[model samples]
Target: MSSKTYAGIPQEYAKLETSKIVLIPVPYDGTSTWQKGADKGPEAFLNASENMETYDIETATEVYQQGVFLADAVTENSSPEAMVEAVHKTTKHFIKKNKFVTLFGGEHSISIGSIRAFNECFDNLTVLHIDAHADLRKSYQGSACNHACAVYEASQTTNLIQVGIRSMDVKETTVLDPEKTYFAHELATNEFWIDSAIDQMTDNVFITFDLDAFDPSILPSTGTPEPGGLFWYETLDFLKKVFTEKNVVGFDIVELCPNKIEKSSDFLAAKLYYKMLSYKFMGENVEDDYDNTYESKAQKNNVTKFNDDEY
Candidate 1:
């Protein structure tokens, strides 16, 4: 029952706290095709979180004000089915305690387990998926419960609205509903489509973000880096709209393969986690404040102490 300061809280129980949010780290990566080290993702993301500021400049709120309790890391399960059961049980416990569970994943496969937990409590829930790959394959290699089939398993429990999808197999394309799926290219070309995409989702939404959804330039630590994908503000704006218009029950951030070479990806992931909290609680008011304060600070800090003439 290790604890740390999160959002100004000096000392709080990891999961038992009445905090608004809980971080559940799932360090299981059994079905990665390209990258093998995704099992280490939870610790990497947690380490990066230590350096993360409580203030979210983009959301204009110290999201930690909402109270984020960092739970103990979940032990890795042997099989996907076991992992799913573990995640489902843990999430149910959190939901019962009235805390919003934000699962930190070892790979995409962890989502199936988390979603199962949510399904036990919420009826008529919909999943809003953000990923570069469709992940609609019934099974990959020999496992139907592979990380590549996370969304496929989730679809069994709830309706799905997939976004930022740039890569998919022909088989997945055939099975997925065209009306429900929003491709990354379509989102890029038509800014107004975001609203239309959100409209397709049910009010009770569970967001699952695979870090690879962003282009490799911004999120290069993913196992499979897609070329063209959502930018920072683009993704944030879409999420803002979702939280404003829909009831986001919970979310999971997955597929972060930390690299010693680039630290930005880890920080970006941590900040985004906090930003989601701000949007869910503060809504549009927070966004406005964030922009005003962040922009003003940038302008104020632009000047150097040393004169340019010295060069």
Candidate 2:
């Protein structure tokens, strides 16, 4: 094993058994529309993550105190369906171990498998989809598994609450629930959008965040860049509320297409990943967090407590 892992933390804290969270990197770049460099997204995100401070100032907690096991990135293949299946199985593996799993991706289409795994694990799942594009097409270019159909299965099976959506196909409107879908144009002056979005969710939520949800100025390293997207603080505020008010089962951040000139986007992805972990664990701390045998401590403190049915 390479000694390096997420947060640049010591190996003891980054090992699987002792950690409360797992970082699954899926560097699979398939079905991208505009950019082709998304295959390097996970690497750039992890490289930037190594430089981040473990302590999250906004959440007032050193979230990395809860050990974070950064697993090896998922192996890429020519077949996109095979890649998604791999992600689905791997994500479910860690979740069964009672780990708080999160994934960073190569493209928006990569979310389909992760979402499927979360659906099987948790009941009454409310998918909080934060993306610039609706991604509700029944099929794109002959594949329902395309980036355009990222949330198609979720919309059919779960309570899908889409937010920060600024782009959509004319046909997508047919499947999209207007009451639950919060559009970026309509939200320019609405402060209650966040509250209403969360209200539409169930107790267990799975977030599928497409990086293009952010404005191109703030986050240009994405497969598709949108003109007017979410800002840093506004996005974080909504996320914090969601983490605080609901049970975030798991999440995946996808669609980062890295570049050499714009390294800030890479850093942003890393910081965003850490910040999400911090918010999720802010109020769920356990005992002996730094101990070598911390899994027992976690159970003792009821930190990672959950029945199979609750998953």
Candidate 3:
């Protein structure tokens, strides 16, 4: 959020009209229960991105060449409901322009708005939620917009598949679909988890990734750190497969509580964002047209809900 352009990219590629991607920064952290520094996540992540190498060794590509437009930060913090509405409207504004939208968050709660926008724009949308906590509560702390209820609406509307979850209250079990929810303990032993998760997803997928999904050993700067979480390569392996197999409409990464002393977490978040973009545009030429394939009329149609037995 501090840099003029994302990662200090050239002005030519950062223009909104020509850019294929739009990055929105929401620096609100009013609902996090434990850690308080997630509001600083976007600034820290941007600073780290400015210092990172643009060329991706694994993909043999410079994704920044595809053009990244850094939109103004959404600073609506007067109330949680008002903030979510602001994010929903701003995110939808970019999607309507046919740009690939991505967001950096203050906490998991921001996903409630981002996911809502994507679900309304795309047909049969799948929300692939990767996090350490279930976050399935319909309401928490007298607020439905709290971080704990981040994906509750997605659960009802989209083909919501949760992964890397290791901690949650017993009450969430009533809402979580066991067949689609991959717990961390089970993932460690399930050899086919990556493929299985992808198989359950619809053609259009929206990824809502919480930084706490990574193990505290590798990414300790998050609001809530849990044991038995994911590692770097394995996480990338799953994401690459998703980008390769499904139409990943857009994505959001959240819950980065940066520590003044530990800088690795910020760099990890930056690299993660770049890597996902690389996977998305690896095969496309920068000169070629980029269409996000969002349907404006789909906003009026209700996506048919499915029962567990339907799958």
Candidate 4:
């Protein structure tokens, strides 16, 4: 398993004690409705990552120099409720260790625990949700922990800012905040919508990215790929702004159902993960080899005060 660490880097750069980032793979898909095999998401991501170039041209930095430690994937729990509980406990443990924890999920349901843990660690956190579906059902399939209810708790506990959402039941409109949620159709040609979305967020941000946020033409391997979604470059533009303007404490990429015939989706997921890391550490000591020496500069440039005048 160690041979397949992200980017397939050597042990010197993947050690737990010296690493700046921790990658937690949650490979449990107990509640998927339409498609199965999402449990293989983590391995597919890791496998694709092994073939990635460490150097990122857009950010002009190789983020792996900061040391990305791939921890043991959470492989227990038979039910969605138990899986969520286990993920929360594991995520909390990592947060307590002061590590920048990133989660790769089996399904959208896994994010409930990760988001909860981030909220506990970071104050005034705003969840920057990028997904095709709202996943906002109050209780789906007889359980609150169902994939459809991934962010129900987040909506109640934290300031939820959803973007790229094109699918949702009308009943969920009750819970959706008009000011914070940006629907896909409304943002068709409006560049200003990015500012509108960012305006509702706090300085401390935790991103929950569902892979289906991309259009089916771009990433059709997800369980519920909706059409008319954000394409690759456009999505990156928003993400770069989020990482630059806000202190993204941590993020999770979920709901990648890998296909045997088409491996592009898996590769794209891996690239997205690495690109986010590069953006997060853009101006830090990311150029040189700082495997055991890099320190976080997230708070140095974050906009803590809410600029209501701009809004």
Candidate 5:
């Protein structure tokens, strides 16, 4: 299938209707240690998105109908501190218009700037971090604002809840609050308390997802792959619950390194973006959009099969 571009002007900004959501693509990856091409992630995801049917199967809504705008990619190269200032200025412009921000990242470090912007508009914000590593180090490779310390910088802004974490160094362990950190092993083995973990979140949430939070089996294109992380449905179920229980104001999806050999990773990331949009905005009305297509037929057939199996 051919790649899809957003339905607006190229590179500057594209708006649909009143523009409740804006996608800011940050294609800068100077500090990545292992993988080098994550700077190309935004374009790859956008290209893959062209083939995605706008309708969501689970939510049953065309979330794109909510009006998504794509902002130009931030391509500046400077110190992490300077980059944060640039992101802050740009994000503050959007926040002034009351638009919800969805940041597409070059690496996890990009979130530091975005979250800094968020703290200005929100007071009781809590971060929901989905990552393979704890990322709680105070500094890494001589930079305090390194990608490895993204979560650490975020915690300075607000309370944090980290999930799907499977790796951490001894230094990270010392700084992190044991109560707020949930390891992937705990989530996989103890399914009964996922709700309890999510319940600890504040009413206003900022979700930051590192692609490595997913099992390397499904998403192997990240810079640092970790095994035994979340599966698709498991992570989605948790997100659904979080959306239902809390008010998610903004979010970021980071660390996607598009590999030509396995294009599924890019497509999956694109689909996940739409799914989150559907859940956040359409809610129960998600299934209402299915009045006109094969999707409705498929959903009905699945429902019928499920009912028949119950007997």
Candidate 6:
């Protein structure tokens, strides 16, 4: 990572020993088929975060005090599969430290690794995949690690709940469960979609948020900009409810393709990240211990198994 501290916080809160949170930046954009600037996302996000106000008004908390250790950027780009493996190992390493591990990504494919690590550590994992596309292809372009197949493993292993879906391939429908998917059109009219989506989640949840899930009018810098997507307040409302009701083990935000002329998207990504952290650690003391509440290895024996052959 280019920045010394996450959001330029003092060294006290940026140290790994005292920090309650770990932020992993995976700046590999090898698999994005559209816009190619997602590799620059982590640096742009860090730069924008440096200028953001640490205080959050809604929660009335400075979540940065919880300490954010910005780990080295995952630069393993030999192949899409290699990058995913590197991300999986790094995320698992932090989760084992009992830290609230979060990731900012180069593309949606990075979620495959982070989600895998979380699913292994948490029992009865529910993957909340918020994206414009279904992204359920078992494999794309001869590689399962392609961005297009980001959540195929989760669909088979975890209780996957999809939201804000407006674009998808017909083949993805075979893997998608309509009962658990909140399509953009349905969400537009459904007054209780938030509650409904939350109700279907298991106790342990891992969120994978794609930037394109937001409408192009609000966030147009994603690799794939989709129309008729989510807005800010409503997205925050849904996220707050999830953090409040579920054991949100970890999360990752992906698909940010920054533009030099338009910097709002970068700031939005930074604020969105801080907002999620605020919700997670709201009302908690920095001195207090943060237990990610992951299942012990023995306890995870009964959890949904991840099969490499399937992927």
Error of 2 at 17 (Å): 0.4
Give me the runs in candidate 4 sitting further than 4 Å from their true place. 1-3, 286-311
Candidate 5 RMSD computed on C-alpha atoms after optimal superposition onto the true structure: 11.4
Each model's TM-score?
A: 0.87, 0.92, 0.93, 0.92, 0.86, 0.93
The best candidate in terms of lDDT? 3
Candidate 5, residues 49-117, lDDT tens digits: the string is: 877887677877777665678877787768876766677677756654556688887888888888877
lDDT per residue (tens digit) for residues 178-231 in model 4: 888899998887879988888888889999999999998989999988999999
- Against the true structure, candidate 2 reaches a TM-score of 0.92
Question: Which candidate, 1 or 4, would have the higher lDDT against the true structure?
Answer: 4
Q: Across residues 1-311, which tens digit of lDDT does each residue of candidate 2 receive?
A: 66777868888789898888999988877788777988899999988888877778887888887889999888866677888888888887787777888999988778889998888777778999999999999899878878899999899988999998999999999999999999999777997998888888988889999989999999988878989899999999999999999989889999889999999999999999889988888886656444434366334333334455643
lDDT of 5 at 37: 78
Local distance difference test scores for all models? 0.78, 0.86, 0.92, 0.86, 0.77, 0.90
Model 2 per-residue lDDT at 148: 91
lDDT string, candidate 6, 30-142, tens digits: 98888999989999999999999999999999999998999999999999999999999999888776678999999999999999898887788999999999999999999
Error of 5 at 201 (Å): 0.7
Q: Where does model 3 exceed 4 Å of error?
A: 1-3, 290-311
- Model 1 residue-pair collision total: 1
Higher-scoring candidate on TM-score, 1 or 5: 1
